[model samples]
Target: MALREQLDADMKTALREKDSLKLSTVRMIKSAMKYKETEPGAAGPLDDAGILQVITSEIKKRRDSVTEYEKAGRSDLADKEKAEIAVLQHYLPEQLTAAELEKAVADAIAEAGAEGPRDMGKVMKVLTPRIQGRADGKVAADLVKQKLAT
Candidate 1:
């Protein structure tokens, strides 16, 4: 089934099971997705990749919140953000391990012929799609810089 259908089904399940956190998270995702579908230029219902894009963006926002909450000494809010992250993460592709990410970055650098930090753009262009939603952009960029500078 398409992600939209899956979300609908999950929403029902969350309701039936009284899973408030999951229900809210799913509802938030569905809301974003519905907005996307009805947006002026949308062609049709979202494909899996499109749905994943929305989920990934949501997760990124939650991660930022987690960081901010932690910095502000609000463990309660940070914990909630972490819980939301856990729920949202189920929709993402498996994350790359440190070794896997390092290897992939090296390959991207080589493929893009990136010889130095100045070539970061070229390497990122080649790398971003390959690792999308699988690796954090900041981590990937840091790894790329480390690899390129050596």
Candidate 2:
């Protein structure tokens, strides 16, 4: 099934199961998707890839919140954000393993013929699409930087 359909089904299941956390997170995702759909130049309803982008963005936001909450010594709020992250993560593609990400970064570097750090953009241009929704951009960029530094 498509992601939209899956979300609908899961939403219904959450409602039935009285899973407040999941229901709220799913609603949040749908809200974000609706907002994206209405954005200027939005092509229309999102495809799976587009929906994945939205889901990924939501997860990132939660992660940032978790960090901020932790810094404020609000363990309760941080735990909430972490739970939301867990809910949001279910919809994303399985994350790339460290070795897999390293290999992919190396492959991108070679494919782009990136000779040094100056060519980071070139490597990332080749890499981003391949890793999108499966790997964190910061992690991938850091790996690229590490590989390029040597």
Candidate 3:
């Protein structure tokens, strides 16, 4: 099934099971999808790739909020954000490990013939699509910079 369909099904399941966290996360994703559809110039319903991007962005936002909450000594709010992040993460593709990400960066560098940090853009242009939804852009960029600097 498509990601959106699966999400809808899961939303029903969450309601049946009384899973508030899952239900809330699914509803949030649906809201984002709906917002995208209603946006000016949105041509059609989002594809799986677009849905994945939206989900990943939501997860990232939660993580960042969690960090900020923790830094402000608000453990209660941080814990809530962490829980939501964990629930949202279930819909994302399996994340690449640091080692796996490093290898991907190396391969991308070689594929793009990236020579120095100056070629970071070229490497990123080649790598983004391959790693999308599987890895965080900041993490990938850091790895790419590390590889190119070596």
Candidate 4:
């Protein structure tokens, strides 16, 4: 089923099961998807990749907020953001392990013939699609840097 439909079904199930966290998280995702649908030039309904991108962006935003809140000594706010992140992550694909990410970066570097950091753009071009929805861009970039430096 389409992600949006699946999310809607899950939302209903969550309501019936009294899963407050999942319900809220799913509703937030649904709202973001709806907003994207209404945006200009969005084309038809978003594909799985597009939905994953939206979910990833939402998680990234929450993570960033958690960092900022913690830096400001607002532990309560940070905790709330972290909780939301945990809930949202339940829908994401299993993340790549460090070792697996290293392998992926090495492969991408080899495929792109990236000899040095100057070829980061080329490496990123080859790596982004491979890692998309499976890992964070920052994490992937770090792995790519580590692979290229050696």
Candidate 5:
């Protein structure tokens, strides 16, 4: 099934099960997708890839919130953010292992003939589409920098 259908099914399931956290998170995802659809120049309703992008963005935001909440010694809030992360993560493609990501970076570097940091853009251009929601962009960029620096 497509992601949108899956989301719909999950939304129904959440409602039936009375899973408030899950229901809220699914609603939030739907809201984000709707916002994206209505954004200026949006190309109509989001496809699975676009939905995944939104889900990934939501996960990233929660991760940042978790960090801030932790810093303020708000364990409760941090835990809630973490739970939300878990809920959002359920929709993501299987994440790349660190080794897999490193290999992918190496492959992209070679494919792009990226000799140094200056070629970061080229490498990323080739890399980003491959990793997409499967890997974190920041971590991938850092790996690229580290590999290129050596």
Candidate 6:
């Protein structure tokens, strides 16, 4: 099923189960997707990859919120954000393990002929699409840096 259909089905299930957290998170994601659809020059409905991109962006926002809440010593709010992250994560592809990510970065570096830190851009250009929503950009970049530095 398409992401739209899947989300709709899940939203109905959440409603039936009276899962307030899940209902709110699904609504938030739906709102974001609606905004994307209405954006200037948007080509109408988003494909699976586009939906995944949106989901990933939402996850990132929740993670940032969690960090801010933690720093402000609001464990309550941080826990909420973490819960939202967990709910949203169900739609995303399985994340790459550290070793898998390392291998992917190494492969990109080799394929891009990236020999030094200066070639980071080249490696990232070749690597980003492959990892996409499956890996955290910051973690993958750090891994790339570690590999390059060695």
10 residues in a row with least lDDT, candidate 6: 141-150
Query: Model 2 Cα displacement at 50 (Å)?
Result: 0.5
Q: Write the per-residue lDDT of candidate 3 for residues 51-143, one digit (tens) a residue.
A: 998888898899999999999999999998888888887888899998888888889999999999999999999999989988999989988
Across 50-112, the per-residue lDDT of candidate 4 in tens digits comes to: 889989999999999998999999999999889889887777789999888888888888899
Residue ranges of candidate 4 with Cα displaced over 4 Å: none
Best candidate according to TM-score: 5
Top of the candidates by lDDT? 5
Flag the better candidate by lDDT, 5 or 6: 5
The sequence of per-residue lDDT tens digits that candidate 5 reaches over residues 1-150 is 999999999999999999999999999999999999999999999999999999999999999999999999999999999999999999999999999999999999999999999999999999999999999999999999999999
The digit string of per-residue lDDT tens for model 6 on 60-80 reads 999999999999999999999
Number of clashes in model 1?
Answer: 0
Q: How much RMSD separates candidate 2 from the native structure? A: 0.7
How high a TM-score does candidate 3 get?
0.94
In model 3, how large is the Cα lDDT of residue 65? 95
Query: What's the distance in Å from true for residue 86, model 6?
Result: 0.2
Which candidate order results from sorting by lDDT in descending order?
5, 2, 6, 1, 3, 4
Clashing pairs in 6: none
TM-score of each prediction: 0.91, 0.98, 0.94, 0.91, 0.98, 0.96
Q: What are the runs in model 2 whose C-alpha is more than 4 Å off?
A: none
What ranges in model 3 sit over 4 Å off? none
Evaluate model 5: give its lDDT: 0.97
lDDT comparing candidate 1 with the true structure: 0.91
Cα-based lDDT at residue 99, candidate 1: 94
The window of 10 residues in a row where model 5 has the poorest summed lDDT is 84-93
* Residue pairs clashing, model 3: none
Q: What C-alpha lDDT do the candidate models reach, one value each?
A: 0.91, 0.95, 0.90, 0.88, 0.97, 0.93
